[model samples]
Target: MAGTSTFMEVVKAAAKQGSAACDSVAIRADQKSYSYQQLVSSAVNISRFLSSEDLNSSAGNGHLNGACVGIIAKPSAEFVAGILGTWLSGGVAVPLALSYPEAELLHVLKDSDVSIILSTEDYHELMQNVAAKSSAKCSLIPSVPVGRTEAEKAPLENFHSSHERGEEDPALIVYTSGTTGKPKGAVHTHKSISAQVRTLTDAWEYTSSDHIHVHGLFNALLAPLYAGSTVEFMTKFSVRGIWQRWCESYHEGIKADDAITVFTGVPTMYTRLIQGYEAMGTDLQAASASAARNLRLMMCGSSALPYPVMQRWEAITGHRLLERYGMTEFVMAISNPLKGERRGGTVGKPFPGVEVKILEDESGNDAPGVGELCIRSPSLFKEYWKLPEVTRESFIEGGFFKTGDAVRVDEDGYYLIMGRTSADIMKVGGYKLSALEIEAILLEANKDYGEVVCAIIVPEEEAKRKCAEELKPAITLDELCTWAKDKLAPYKLPTRLFLWDSLPRNAMGKDEVVIKAKILGSKLKQNFDIPSEQEASNP
Candidate 1:
């Protein structure tokens, strides 16, 4: 591609010089190590196959020329190869989350108009059906074989050199969680993706020395790879497995080659980890804490980090979780400084080279300090795929994308996200309140109640035991109101309370607050004689 270098360029350049680090381990998954050389070789072979007449008659000269290639695989070497191969064939790669249901998966496949679907053998049956339903061809991505002899090597062809695809050409299309509505495909060009990876690498100070333990795909995997760092993948987030892995990494004061130096997860993961720690024995706690504290960096994102959770995690691990802010539209545009104080309940400053504004209201007025957070970044997505009208409405006159998040600058110039304007913002008795702020306080209160507010799934027997064990009565609306009187205004108190073993969450671990609100609204009207919106706002 012209005017900018893709990540593949850096990989190829390092390979050309026969750099030892370039051939070092790139991905560690399922007790297997995939080297950079093997990754590139597999990608090249896949690119050749994609261009062959066997795949499609339209694929002349083996170049995708920006066609869409749907990639379906778990976090593994084959997934990496699929993405690289798509780029090598000049095709746009769209990573379909495995957690999506059949209908949603089919929606995305058809929406993106994917020309081909590449997946591993495990998912061949499912993907073939999806491909058939979406009118796309399907193929199994070959395993990336290790051990390449020098005689078998050749000068790698620059995939974009022949195709007229430029830096602005579409390279990736990632769909959002679609909690509120149908998922929209966020289109990211090569330049935008490079900018995001570079920003994250610089912000997190990623290097070859860092071994990242990734719980999810996307930024976690791609950023480390771009920085030439080793990535250890955990297909599923197991609290026990994570703690055990850290202990094994630093066993007997000996740091292994695969020692985890960095780890990132959502707030729920941290919350679970804290619960797991509390359940450990005294001796086990000491060892787990020591091992976790030894890690160079521990980060959290994808949702707000509760202050109580942060404090408890720091007390246990001696590492204050580095919290950052991002969305599917733009990978990460703001982050707390790696070497500075990470304030709890705040998502630090705008990232370098990113501009932010506050759109206060419908008139596009800029509030003194609080409003909807608008962002213009080099890493911003090109457009929402095939939704030009929606995409056009998403941006302002000067290209700042409306984030739909209400935020304000603290006295120290840090950004504090109030909450999402749609769901988190609530009007009560002529006053506006932030549900997230109240939820944080409620979460902290749960700790004081001396009973863990586990996911509502605890068995009835366990619930009875917990309630009986705690000397205090169960927390009630009145009790919460009394507790919060000092911290919040009268209108900010939660008028209703629904205690559950666990809050419902999407695949990303974010609370399905909007949907829950609708369910709650219906129940409130039927059982509690709750006033309508207009009535509530009046008096």
Candidate 2:
């Protein structure tokens, strides 16, 4: 990888081609397109400003020279430019999520030791306050110029080329999702960035016409840009907008010029999309289904995809979501192949050049086929920022990052991630159980006839609606157990259910509190926030 083209080099090459193909769109945001030339020009301007500020600082280097820069912007040309400018000036880029609350935002700014904050105008005031708290300077990221005439273009000077820095030089620091644990900054080197984009570009067959976005930074913008593909930004997730976009993609058997060819998302997104689909009328449903079917591919990850959601989506759209697995430590490693049979409930084999192993239990005892999943991949992050001991402890023998996930391989070699060792694996009546496995199965089904399974309950909208109409609980302990009898063992099914009005959740949408309670013998209990006067049996 030392001699291979860096991520910047790949992007720059694409930008150069934009000189002749001036209309070649690089990014689409806010209902407008920005060409690659505009991106490069804007990045160069930011790089110059950053360089001059460093030169003016008596003790600072001539350029950023590995200083950390915090970027805050919606998915747009401005965001891309900020990162590029940081790289061109020999700095590390830390992207701050727009969803973060004030306290969480403060934590990231302080944790990353950010020297400067570059944000869009929308967040200028907020970023200014946060940057001051962290003793970092805040600046407005320049808006990238679009559709500039050839004569109006200014030459870029002193821009660092791909060869200026080795692939191992640190490039990006993306924080962990914090779904299972505390968020940590996982630093990725230029080489790792290059590896990920190339790995994804090849694995998914990303072309100039296609658009993808499961991993927005990598899959949508960076990787697609490297492959000279146009990136259309959906800054916010809108059910109606997404469905309308798909419908607009193909109409009357003709592909729209801006039709999306490929897309990726999390399991929650797929579930939402399915909800959106089911809510559509018959004529609109037919159009959406047809458009989605014609798309080159659709994929899901970031959590276990419920079996029923997958089944229903396939029944409607004929696309079996290519579920994959990865984390902040590594952008992506294992996935169901694009062309092969997508096995349900499995996150297919490791990508080419990626290696993985399932480790034995921590108690010096083998647990048959199930164990912690460890990964070693070219795209693996360099380290957890500022946490030497934690970083060292994260990996095991042979440089493998010991992912705390529990997983088992199926007969066909596909990996099924059970869940995090501490967060997901459960010992119920001395039997090992996977909460994720149980959830994927349980979320797909439930029936009621006065009998029940008292599991952790988050009844679906449909269930609630039915209960409202019938004036009876939609699910009971006996009904759940009976339905799950063949799908899950007795020990795996929850004996107690907590049906809260609405559980508090963290930014990553993980439950924050369980509201622990004693389980009395099976008896009828008042439903929490039920739309109807329904009765449910509880343990």
Candidate 3:
């Protein structure tokens, strides 16, 4: 278990532990519970299905290695089965998000070079069209078998051994959000997956006794399942669903039977949850807070968690939410201590076996203060599929991957994520201000603004819009200046503001401020009353 191994090893180990002791709940979806045995059996069936389809095209020639299988099933027992089955058959599993439209789905399938597409009944039509367009075969996931009576049960004498998958073999191909350009596939070897699972399990103390209600996809799901925790999937992330689930978990007493012990979500989800709690009546708020308090852990990541939101959540739930930092390249590297002070603004120290450094700009050296974040970890992705040049440029002289994020270490050793070095780090009047920091302040000042985004506005465009339609600032310039006067330094306040109906978001739901800035700059030139040539050239 300490060495590098394939994901199927987890399934095999659970199977070898005997049906009774290891026969616990694995996945709960659509009100149906799937036992561990049932999950493994379904994986076996999926393996047979792939064999029948000649996915390997190697009847008796040799084992199937490096073959890619695209999985488009909803988060259910079938999804788990597809992944395990792909591993068992010595194939790479590429989990496609259902949120993707047809064009996006086709792009991923063709890019990954999938030989077969595995999907549930709900996605059959869409996936079938995608497979046809991509010239790939589509297969329906086998139904999980059940209802074997006690009298007919056989002794646990012999069972099929797990697939012989080496640690260095590729196991997963996850695509990036395509925020910068086209999405590129990120390859993760079996060893990397194993390392991430071990790190998360050790850090979070995931055990058979724990049941986590998960709202995220990919790494969040795989890492938890690999550690043998029961994952209850809520296909849709409804605020009502989450609160009701928490209430039901503790309806009886302090000691809950089916209580969810762990929870993880993005910052936006937590923000919405906080809003939901605020809207609740006094009696309902008490119940929601108490139920949430009984949970063992609540983790936030994938984006900067606003300090004000973090403070409000602590006030309501009496639990300090653990904040962490991670990306698609490396599942998770930095996390607040499970048993120590969970800081509000800082993402805690690096996990074991992970080394982090900040590379300064002008000095091109490791500095004590703010700089680019570089990470060297065993859990890092092997490469970006089919992008050798891009992959080569992503790392330093050593094996450290440049995270493209700007960060600084505080006196207490907790790392504060300024934001993405390329976008969120804004240069204003010779001073650098973190957009995330300003957004946090703005959110605190104006709760009515559902989403607040800060970007460097083109002054010329503001002048044009102001003259053309008699446009007014969404938040008065004077008001912002006054509100932020004490909270932030003068250099950090927005000298120029761009008001919009909404911020443009990338595929991953992240605001693309860099692109927005360029677009707005062009519009500013068209709209603003141009200054004289000398003035324009000077400023």
Candidate 4:
């Protein structure tokens, strides 16, 4: 944490070794392959631009020199280059999600006090406006040319190593998905970033020969790149495309040169993939299953994985989904093992250097052994940016970060997340119940309910017709209790139910449970002939 820069170490190593040693394709996207040399070349170019005399003068300082650089680009070579360039120029990278609205983008930009915004041309107009709103300078990220000659490449001469940063310097500021409230920036340092990437690389057995398929660019992209693995990026997640790609990779019983060995995604993606598989014709389903099973690893995270989804996926693909627990504060801490039995409904033991403990609830009212899951790891973020008091409160006396997740350990010492301490744990009749556990049980019990759960409004006339066509009445409180009678304790059953269209989800595919509950609760009150406006006050 004192002397070195983690990302720069990889860059410098690649640079010193030249093409052959680091020459494997580091990124494949949009039907193009980019070598590690090309990626480093592009990053050096961007670094030079950032350190130019004119730009420095305009920015009101000599150089970025450990300042924040807001990056707004889709998952591509440009995004990776931008991050590397920021690090090369002694700046921290703050990746602003493209999925964020203008207001949310501005909020993050202003909150981090970003010195500059580097975005692709596609979002130039929008990013310009966002930059204006946040008072941050804007620049276009030059397209990374493929197979370019040395003479044509941007030189790193103008870039000064005098601004090089230490491991303790801030390297990234990723905002939490604001499902609860306003998003908070979690600041990660170079040391923490290195620890995370190294842990994942060692745990997953990543290597230069492996190819990882990634959707969004967080741990999925960065970790593999750090391990010198080739990363294939998808512009967006498509169940059909994913299956088809896998099928293509292993066509004619031979593995293609660009075969993807590892894949990671959220639980909802798997659920959708299962739905896609089920809808496929017999022959196509067989091909998809065979292709998917050949992949070395499949992982699921971001939200609790439903048992049914995991079971069905394994039944089809033969690979049990390795479920893991992580948060924005720490990229990853606990994960189901790559070699050992990956048990369903439990995130396995801590990573090699990570320490975990279950802090018993002070109320002493929870079910035995249930408490807040706490973690102390080298990979833990430095702080919640600009919120010193909040950051201090988040950790206990021994530097264990309170994860705000309720968890209980299984007999084998694997951790089973009960739910979020605030939102996912519901108190009913003096007993705390995990909404996720209930959701999982409901998903299995109601086979005819299909893939989705939760409520949404529809036309009153059409709603009745649809209910009749489905051959089931709108799921009612009595119906839910009757079905959950044997599966759940009486207190754990849903007291109220409104069968509607769909659930609201955030960008990361996590269900917005708190917001949905409030909306559905309000609608239920309205249906009961109570005033809608009074519902909020009553709750």
lDDT per model, in order?
0.75, 0.72, 0.72, 0.75
After TM-score superposition, the amount by which residue 499's alpha carbon in candidate 3 deviates from its true location, in angstroms, is 3.9
Error of 2 at 400 (Å): 0.5
Model 4 Cα lDDT, one tens digit per residue, 1-539: 25553656765455433434356788899989887777877887787787762344544444566778899888889999999888877788999988899889988989998888999999989999888877799999998887756633434343455555788889999998776456899999888888888788889988887889986455688788877888998889898999999999888568999998889898778878888898999999999899888899999998878777788889999999998888889989999999998989888878999998788768878877788889999999999999999899999989999988889888888988887766555455566666666666776655442434452212221110001111124566566668768998866655444555566677677765555556655565544322123221100
Q: Write the per-residue lDDT of candidate 2 for residues 292-379, one digit (tens) a residue.
A: 8889988887666767778888998999889888877897899999998899999998999999888877664435778998999999
- TM-score of every candidate relative to the true structure: 0.90, 0.87, 0.88, 0.90
Q: Residue-wise lDDT of candidate 3 within 1-539, one digit each (tens)?
A: 22534456775566444544256777878878777766776676576566556666653433456788999887788898898888776788999987787888888888888999988998998888888888788988876654543421333224343343578878899887765655789999888888888788889888777788886554456666766778888787889899999999988446566688888887667778988988899999999998998899888877677676688778888778898888878888999999999988889999999998778888444345888889999899999998899999999978899988889888988998876665555444545556656666655665542555343322322221111011223667677778778988876665556566566554344544445545555655654343322222100
Q: In model 4, which runs have C-alpha deviations exceeding 4 angstroms? A: 1-5, 15-21, 53-62, 151-160, 216-218, 448-451, 455-476, 526-539
Question: Who is ahead in lDDT, 2 or 4?
Answer: 4
CA shift of 62, model 4, Å: 4.3
In model 4, the worst 10-residue window by lDDT is 462-471
Please provide, for model 1 over 1-539, each residue's C-alpha lDDT reduced to its tens digit, 9 standing for 90 to 100: 67655676766554443676657788888878877777777787787777772343465676677788889988888999898888877788999889888899899989998888998999999999878888788999998776675622655553334543578889999998776467889999888888888888888888888899986555688778877888998888898999999999998668988899999998778888888999999999999998998899999998888787799889999999998888878889888889987888889998999999888766434356878889999999999999999999989979999888888789997888877775455454544555566666656665632232321111121110001111123777677678878887765555555554444577777765554445455544544323233222100
- The true-versus-predicted C-alpha distance at residue 335 of model 2, in Å, is 0.1
Model 1, residue 192: C-alpha shift (Å): 0.4
lDDT order of candidates, top first: 4, 1, 2, 3
Deviating ranges (above 4 Å) for candidate 2: 17-22, 55-61, 149-152, 155-164, 178-182, 213-215, 362-367, 446-454, 457-473, 501-539
What's the lDDT for residue 162 in model 1? 57
